[model samples]
Target: MVNSITGLISNIQRYSLHDGPGIRTTVFMMGCPLRCAWCSNPEALSIEKQLMIFDQKCTLCGECLIVEPEAISLDGGLRVDRALIKDIESLAHCCPYDVFEIIGNEMTVDELVDECMKDEPFYRNSGGGVTFCGGDPIVQADFLVEVTKSLKNRGIHVTLDTSGGLPWDQWDKLASAVDLILYDLKLHDEKRHIEYTQAGNSLIFENLDHLAKLGKEIIVRMILVPGVSDDPKDIELRCKRLRQSKANVSLIELLPYHTLGKGKYTRLGMPYPLGRNNEKDKVNVEEIIQIIESIGFKVYYRSP
Candidate 1:
């Protein structure tokens, strides 16, 4: 009976199909432990509220400059020096045209449920419910558990889309709250996992094993990143682990490599670390499907 609980949310996307079984309301929470190079939602990586400067949306009216002219400058185009600002939160109100938009929202569990209840009709018709997603929603496990408990009490199907990088104790708490788990397996080798995702896979594998033993309905998602996670040996090793776990895997999804998040770096004034290798990292969907099917698991493809 947890009544008062609040979580930092990045976005609450409605009618999302690829996240789960049906049309789902994917609640994207802020913060993540691992920093994956190919993260699609870069804004959600940090726990704090961030400001995104969409230059395309700017009219160069210099309304934001009035708030902090020293922090922001207009040369050829508008440029915001985020480093110079002490209190960046105040700048979000300075923009009238939404060129500088804050990307996080703090909402209580009751408030969030009220928002989700608006789409209950859609959920019932499409066999879709609510999905708790990232930047690794498991980072806010306690908040998620409470919110999910409330959702389930209302007879809503809840799904957790996670990277399985959290503690086993947290996973134990979530096992009863969620209806399904959409787990991500990036790399099989521990060293390689650290090299790319900036985290180890030991806890991930351990938690997966524990969840499988509990017989939770799970869907494993593996993103095919060329020269990084797309290695045949890595894929085979991951599949072997899944087979050994004996978890009820509804599907094994192979998401192809894409440059969808490349522009996000420019928006955040950060360098794109993956370079221009997205084109080369692309995988053949049909071939991957066949390979995964041969491993005695149902395979699905989402092209890059």
Candidate 2:
């Protein structure tokens, strides 16, 4: 008997510094348990191949339209007939300017390892390695476990950027393999959590609690949505929870909400429920850092 597993990968970002400790390759996996209104990676929201159109880049070359089993039409831009779509690769490749893009690809453990290893010199030189970010990588625990094992064997550091919404029992081994956990904390209030994230915070809290109890290295990444989760009291409560959880909260990173991925929704022909928070001046990173550090935690801003 043999065990073989392949996971759907959304993208493999190379030479990324913000993802972890040093220069690293960040593997973006598909599928997520929660749909946060402010999610930046709209392409990673679904666990399937999604067509993205950039009309500005389209020269009306008609290359994509000429392909047999024609999946695209030019109605002011490259419009894909979802019902007629067959080979995603075929349609995507037909584009010369790459206006038509495919979001996800399938990769086996060995294949992904090969890709990650290509940047071994960079990782070694910078004390950086590989990070598995998602739509929650925990969804593909088995595949991640195997890939993590391989990376660890090569002395490469591994970081799992997760929402911490899945059952701990399912990926406890994977957690043990990780050098750091980039845990996301959206909202502390349960009702508000569901209202924004389309899910409750119970499981996320439980998983974080258990991981903290295990004394795993964790860095909490909180999204600062203006008027939504920017309350000082709520932030303080969250910090207190982390302090009580006993998790080695090395850093608390406040990520200010951006409308970067909002355009992606338009490209995908989907509704962008998370509109821009125009009151950007309201976000005070220094003050938030003070509140978090008051609870004895270090703080950083994803963007100030």
Best by TM-score: 1
lDDT of each: 0.85, 0.86
Per-residue alpha-carbon lDDT of candidate 2 for residues 1-304, written as tens digits (9 for 90 to 100): 2336898898999999988899999999998888998887878877787778777898888887777346677777656776787776787788889877888888888889989999999999999999999788988888999999888989999999999887889889888889999999888899999988999998888887799877889989998888888888889988888888888889998887877777888888888776655547487667788899889998988774
Which 10-residue span in candidate 1 carries the lowest summed lDDT? Answer: 276-285
**Model 2: lowest-lDDT 10 consecutive positions:** 272-281
List TM-score per model, in order. Answer: 0.94, 0.90
RMSD per prediction, one decimal? Answer: 1.9, 2.4
Best by lDDT: 2
Model 1 CA deviation exceeding 4 Å by range: 280-282
Task: Give me candidate 2's TM-score against the actual structure.
Answer: 0.90
Model 1 lDDT per residue over 28-81, tens place: 999998889888788899999887888888888888777888888888888778
